[model samples]
Target: MGSAVSSAAFSTRPGLLDGLDPEQLAAASAPRGPVCVLAGAGTGKTRTITHRIAHLIQSGHVAAGQVLAVTFTARAAGEMRARLRGLGVDGAQALTFHAAARRQLRYFWPRVVGDRLWDLLEGKLRLVAQAANRAGVATEAEVLRDLASEIEWAKATLVSPDDYPAVAARTQRDTPAPAAQVAEVYRNYEKIKNSAQVLDFDDLLLHTTAVLEEHGDVATEFRDRYRCFVVDEYQDVTPLQQRLLNAWLGGRDDLTVVGDANQTIYSFGGASPRPLLEFTRRFPEATVVRLERDYRSTPQVVSLANKVIGAARGRPAGSRLQLIGQRPDGPEPRFAEYDDEPAEAVAVAGRIRQLLDAGVPASQIAVLYRVNAQSEAYEQALSELDIPYLVRGGERFFARKEVRQAISALRVATSRPSGADVVEQVRTALAGVGLTEQPPPGGAAKERWDALLSLVELAEELAATVQDADLARYVAELEQRAAAQHPPTVEGVTLASLHAAKGLEWDAVFLVGLAEGTVPIQHADGDDSAIEEERRLFYVGVTRAREHLSLTWALSRNAGGRRHRRRSRFLYGLIPEDHPAARVARAQGKTFGGATARCRVCGGGLTATLEVKLGRCARCPSNVDEELLERLKSWRSDRSRELKVPPFVVFTDATLVAIAEQRPADDGALVSISGIGATKLERFGAEVLAVVRAAGRG
Candidate 1:
């Protein structure tokens, strides 16, 4: 672990090294040799590397055209080019690995293979679907995503289809399908691509490497053309990527790699931190510099980030770069707990409202969660609060293809009365589109499944609260939702997953849904390595907060549901075990809820959606069915529309919620409810009683 380096350590210099700290200046102007930069999160890695490129150009060490810099994403590549241009240096090749490789392959294919280069595949889902069919596999749209990921992994790891099964089995890879079936799919995918004369993203790198490796003259020309190389996010280098990097170097050592081993959370995508960790071993005389001073987050946030990553197991000794915050201290991170998922979302949105009210620009704040599926509740909650929010790098809730299809199916279902439970009816409709209880293997398919399953949860909530909930009304709500999440003229708070939130920062970050199964995730249960990666991902989330940070989770998924969820184990050492936010000490089974939840009406355990939302239960002397209240509200809304009156004219929302909690079985008890008088009861008594009876509440 590196110690804190104060500003006293930085030495002033002229030209490109003007504002660079001592470590950065050393790394930037290091002798012409292999350079390794262990750039911790929030450290000025981009600044150091980009300045180094400019330094090399102005100092006559390397020509601008010969400098090839590659990063993982196009946005980062574009930023690199823009920064280089800002420094008054032009003609440098700053591009994504695929972009750089595609250009090289396109230029060399005719010379090397004596034929035209095939069309490059921007996405492999279409081809994977075809391959799935050829393999006698009936793949859904989501399964195609899983297959594509598996195929990409195999190709990146340089494992042939014949070797994929053994490699996958050896690594205990959680393949989308059986090892043999996936291998067959991969084999057929290659065959189909070959017959169609096309190359994918991975094939570009592979082909470029092959051209250089086979043709000595071409390799010499390429190496001479591009004399200096700088690779960002070196910890994410897959085996195939590293091989191509080596071919680009052509046995020379004019290479610089910037990465942090602790931030290596993309292992599932075949990325290995080995290249970054063993950089010195590859080039014995490499100049290694560790940039531990973080300039983004405050000391309080930095300390939390350090603790999170430090708690991970199997991290290489001395390889974990301990971050030292360079910024002034702000407020300490806040930890919050809620009763359920919806409660969590509402609370987060309310906190954001407070921040916005206090004059923090919405664009400066963010709400990040473990997965994209968790985005829907936040979207709905924000919309309810009239708080603008944009789902960054994810599909908006109602805009998803599955959601649109499910809504269309539900619309068709309203043609006749099914008389079935709304939740069950939703299940039937979703199943018509191949969405069932069990989700497919991880990746796009699993994410799609999660997105669709969230709809079922909404239906369950609808049925729990609304006695007269039907397919038509549910479809109406979804349509309203589709229209509600519109783009605002003003910049909105960002909602993104942890993976997407990487490389970004926010002033106030609300990290929600940190429950046991969500942050560590259920799939990482048995694997220590997977769990460690989760820890790293959590660390990433923690570091994204520049000042105000709130880490929150819920006791249950829904109101009144069993509060059995344990806080994420990653927080065990970070937060106090006996704190109110952490309700239990899992190892000791000790309880820590500040206030025990008890039903007000019957003093019984409150553990279901309606029960918690109502704060009461059935079997009380005066009762109103929570389910019946929802039914009354739905009926009241439709009735009010017919009568050309407001919904409150039929029955207030509070009255309906109270009715559900009271579980009133008779007209006498119904009239006793605050919102129901003798006159009002006379008008709607028969219809309300019929709904309650249908709900088995009367």
Candidate 2:
């Protein structure tokens, strides 16, 4: 340590490793030579990686500029850079794979081929459509999109156009087009891209790997420049990415990778955990470290995550790292079942409202779903409740159909020689799409208009920032920004897809749509690997919770006036009927009658006559006063109409029932209800008590 410290700049920092636990400290200080850290969620993976970088530089084992740290997103790269700066380290290169490859390609393009590199193609679907036309592959737009995605997957897996059909056939993976037709489309796509002198995102890695492999001198230059390499989220690395890393290293062993195989949720994008799983075999001298202590979630949450991952199949032996909770004991993760999607959404919104009243910040709570489509119900429910929320990782603003239409019109309108002002062009585009300053009628339509307006504002701001900014340059910049756009931060509840929730944590998480076809995903029906990836995705969702966690699923989904669904198999053993963590809530449908009565709090059914007379299941507390509850509901309805808001916004039915049972006589007592915050108490507290008093007298 003494010899290593003399040449480094951070020798004076005394408490660099004080906060890290023993395992994390060992990982941070491990000797550098093909090191692999299997870091589970909330196990201080970022801290360990950043501290390891600092340790290497402070010990003088690697120069700051000579280290290359690769992350999966621009935000992650920024976070790592900030951490390194805090540790008194500078000049280290932290970049995403695409960013790093794009840089190298730009720097070495002239040296390698002596020709100008084309701009990356922004409209992949357009190119795919053109290819479809050339190949005479007449199909619906959905089929065309599926083909485009398959082409991307093939490219990432390094399958040639000629080999795509064979590979797909051998693997029996589902495809929208026939194998021959898909291959034809792929070949035509290549021709179209070559003719236009453009490259898509995947080509960035493909072309760089080609250049480095074809030119040993160029590879040697990179190898000399970057002496140490560290990769984050290594479990999601594509084969092509692995090859690029190997080419850059050129047989050197100065490599460290950190990831959790159980959190590998991107197999649909052709990412595989094999590179991480087989790190020891790839680098025979590798030092492997496992970080198991989870500092983010409570013991209950950690245990539930462990149980979910333990049931997953096809994981490598000894690869299942159980998380030892580092936080105090808390409530067990809850499971709620609903009759349908809309009912499930309402129940979840009510629960979120309760949590908010209990003083949990909205930002600390998240609603996670298996797919983007599941968000619509929750969005409607939250909107009805007047709850603020921000949807992440769903459709991008620029990708919306209306926005795209507007942009298309703008491109044409601005292409003229007269060259109208940016604002005028935006106006023209909106006019063409039948949009004006006034918002649309429906909530969804209004949202689309707002998104387009934001785009217009963004254009105006960009133009103002740059004097004489033309429409063409402005459009190019917009495309670039769209490609790199991360989810925006807003003060509201988060609604995100499971994929988007990775590497993020919350104090409470609601995992919705855990039904059979949704969680396992219909696409993974016959594929073992695909199913395993779905399980991993569930694991990722479970581990995102720091304290409170809830899993919800609907018994049916309505389509064309028919209901269909089945419970997700993964939840069978996890939330059995007798499980202490499980709860059932009645959906907005027919109630149980005859021989049994269902608990309104926990979905459990009560069969005995005494239990039925008590009007509560064995699991939850006794029922509220029915007549008083009806009076409260009537009052809420009248108040909602008076305020021109939804009934739930005034106060949820659950909150009203709680108030009736408590019989709060004043504002202070009213505020004690689960959903009655200070705002509600001040606004309608007196009226609520008057209703209660009148009901009591009656």
Candidate 3:
């Protein structure tokens, strides 16, 4: 029995380097000091990092608590910690860059500044708007939001207000506002934040770096505490983060960085792959290892991803790491074309239903697109089909407007320096916000209320664990928890943007809206570097599949009433002329030229006049009452005129057809149709249904 027990236990515990390829093993076992791992997509980068940490600990080179592992997202950090636990290691400092800085600030704040840390300013845009107003700059919400983004970009790149115009001219980057105007707003915004005595998220890293640089003892303490560092997605490191990392290292070269230059897609957010590209120059003796073996995607998908990456220019010459797929051969990726966006969404939804029917778990599939706005049609289609799906990278729970408002109120009530009981302070904050009453009836409002209530419950639980139960301490913990929170892992299909889908994989993946303007993204029109990053974004999407993959695009968009679109240029180069997928896409495009232009509403054949310009077919016999249909058209036309956009932008003719056919009486029923989502439903549901009721009476 003892021998059998020992065998089972040993079987459960995998060896540190059991399944790693030779290159990965080399990376994991390399001597310490400035190691760089150029890991391609689907390569076992995470595995290599985890194994390396375990090896270091098991070999008695470093204690678990002394190693700091940083990743780009909370999900990645949690996965690293879990993997370490499985490897019989714990208490390691696995966190995001912001989380690590926040911890350091909390630890050294008293020693450096001799006071409690100020609250983090969550209303950054609001403050920017106020500053813009005071500075006599345009205070339009859109302008403020753009300027706020510019401010963030400036800080991340360590550009000061005085240097804004010179930097903008040097880079030849376009700004939504004039460079001088943006500079004015940035200066005023800083003055306002300083007057308010609050630090924004960026200020956490800035302040921590300041503390470390100005105080030798604190810097020494941190360096002694964390002797080794491992940074994941090192290509996306911004200058500010690099400076902070350097401060923590105290000029030591004990760092392991893993990234792929081909996957650096966040240049717009002030990230650069230059650090990863120049690692060898910075540390001449650095050991460099490349992991080319892809363990996530099948051979076909891997081939396509490599082809996409090959088209990218401006990469370090001869430094591109091509991925070799290890997963078994699977179906060649499907390329589907549709007449319009709505129809494309319908077809994709049908395929998802089929996959689920074939016993594939809903959680094993994802539908990825270029922008968040592209998710509406897919969300509507999935909801109509009753397939459970989760939309990632939307307003996160903590970042929602309603949640922010509640948190702001809580901050006000707890901002006092007096030592108040945590539970009482939280109760007072909830009561102050008028959340003491029952939650309101609307779905969104109810969710907001539940989030606040959950915070209250958390405070009570926290109070039991600490002495004195200070509200400030509770708030600090709350902020830390929010930073590390991941989207709840409900069983559902994931709908995410390509940027959000990095480091994630699905058994079956759908890449949608691969049109020229959408994939290269309209902003990237004439810029070579931006286009290359777009191609890298496409590569990221392609490599997310393990078995099945589909690349889809529409011939025209429904929003602007049938503006024609071409296939993405990246696809044109990546899919060779003789390739079967290319041929399939071309063949699919041919179906639209015949006399078979179908009704966007019901998919019925349209007569010649109706077929022209995609008009509705009278002979098809509308399921919608004729009067109701006319009224919806009138409402859409008026809204289009009010918004100064095309009529279809308000509600496409196809969506009207769906609404008429369904005759939804309420918001719940109205949102069930394709093309109608929360925003549209909230904007037009009452009026649309009022028209339906009048028609019913008529």
Candidate 4:
């Protein structure tokens, strides 16, 4: 293990160190030379990495400043840093690859591009995009974004443009981009970046590696300064990131990396674990550690997660991922099916309410979905129920108008000696918030800028007014932190689409919109690797459940009552046939009533249904025509959309069917139906009453 032992063996610390697991201890003790830690979900992969960093620092094996820890996301880096600080070691560098690349770029920009190059070249790429669009090239912003992402993926994987076709062909298995075009753009983009001395997100790493590899003194200085490197999510490293890591090592080859190949889900984004997998091959002297015991899930849930991954391709079998249950006999992962989506939403809201009543905190629950569009139903349901929930990603905070305006003000006021990272932050925030449309004038916009900059001015004045240096310091630190992570205004529950939910966890997770196309995802089925990635997504959703996991899907979406959705295929073979949901499916049969089923009033059978109910049969006549039936239902549902509307106000299928069947000619008769309460009768009583009377008269 190279003499870096567990905290328990050291007998130096008290709280956190005393409770270290053996796997964690082993991870801490292993001497670094391209180390790879393959662990299952909740097996304390994060714990092992954090402790190892702590051990390195506490043992004086590396200076805090010499240690560089790279994570896949800014949030993950922040979390790792917080954990390290809690262990009383604070000097180590913790940042995302992007952040690290930006830092290094700033350090070497003067030499790379001479003086004053960054400012003039700012947003030139946007101009390029505009020109490309104007020139009648493929220019839809969305298409450009996709192409830009394609370029980034190639760069990140360290795949030169020439290699893009073969690699993309193999990895994508379908929809491969033309190799020649990729090469041309790759060449053009590089030329532009070099000439302008500016870098896009990927160029940060690409150029930094170039500068370091070309300059021995610069490389050596960085390598010697950072003797220890700790990497989290090692499975996600692209070739470019690996090259950057090699440059950081500067041939020293001393480092600690923690990752799990099974949890590798970013392959589509051009991230690969081959570098970590081939770590020993490259160094010929490296250690590998496996952490399989999960510390977060129950035996049953862990078993489910393990079984799903076990069925996946390319993953090793023996080291199956397992979960360690924290509570005694938590609820089993339940599956439910509904005739339509609104019912599913109501059911999910009902489940959350039940959990809350049983003692789960609102913050403890998270509702995850395959995409942001799927969140609409859950948000609607939650709003109706008055439940508090936060979406994980998307432009919630960054998209707010007030917040954007406020940040523009702050950026201008705090624009003192701002480094590249700070400048990028301000630029991104300003541009994202739509302030760029009427941006403050460079020199002429000073007064207008200060006018909008009142928030920052007030905060500074407040800091000056406070007598407690500690309080003032705290305020200043908070201002800096806010300036870094949050924009001016922050409100509403997080609304993260699934792509944005990576590297994050919540207490109670509701994975809504778990339908076939959305989950395996419509686009994922074309490739085997992509399918495996989808399985990993399910794994991510499952592992995210610290206590409760609820999975749901809708039979229909849209206001027109279009019903053409199927349950997620990923859940097909894994969940047992005897499960409650399977039995429900068996009962419903393969084909069921969908949206636009013929009105019982008109006596037409648009779609056939098995005899599962009493009121409507294949032979019955609908009270009103199809359009009238649909209109009545639409009116009823619209009322349901209003906050605080009682359940009965929204006519249940049974009640609607009864009204259609009986053709009630008056309010007295309509009020007699099930679920038609006094409140509903008073508010919508006349509407229903008139519909019935009109139907009878016609």
Highest TM-score among the candidates is held by which one? 3
List TM-score per model, in order.
0.71, 0.72, 0.76, 0.71
lDDT for residue 66 in candidate 3, whole number 0-100: 92
Model 1, span 336-404: residue lDDT tens: 877789767766876897899889888789999988989877876664444556677645656667667
Off by over 4 Å in 2: 1-13, 394-488, 559-564, 576-698
Q: Please, what are the lDDT tens digits per residue for candidate 4 over residues 1-698?
A: 12233434444333545566776666665654556666667777777788877876776667788788888876677667657766666678888887787787787777766764253243434644643444344656765565566766777778886777787677642332355555555566666667665657777787788888998877876776778887888878887888888877777777777776767778877787676666666766566666777667666666667767767887643234454444456667777766666666656776776777777766566677777777766665665444545556543444445545755454453544433333343444444433354544332133234323433333443335443323233334335444335322222233456666666665567777778788888888777778988988888787776666667776666432666888887777766688666222322232221423333444343321222221344466444355556656876777667633443325555466667766667677766553354555665678777766665566
Q: lDDT, candidate 3, residue 174?
A: 84
Q: What is the lDDT of residue 683 in candidate 1?
A: 66
Deviation in Å, model 1, residue 672 alpha carbon: 24
What value does the lDDT take at residue 200 in candidate 4?
70
Question: Alpha carbon lDDT of residue 19, candidate 1?
Answer: 87
Model 1 spans with C-alpha error above 4 angstroms: 1-13, 114-116, 395-490, 582-698
C-alpha displacement of 235 in model 1, angstroms?
A: 0.5
Relative to the true structure, candidate 2 reaches a TM of: 0.72
In order, the Cα lDDT scores of the candidates are: 0.78, 0.78, 0.78, 0.62
Better of 2 and 4 by TM-score: 2
Clash list (residue pairs), candidate 2: 584-602, 584-603
Report the lDDT tens digits of candidate 2 across residue range 34-126.
Answer: 888889889999999999999988888999999999989876876676578667787898888988899899999999979887799976888
What TM-score quantifies how close candidate 4 is to the native fold? 0.71
lDDT value, candidate 2, whole model: 0.78
In candidate 3, what residue range of length 10 has the lowest lDDT sum?
A: 1-10
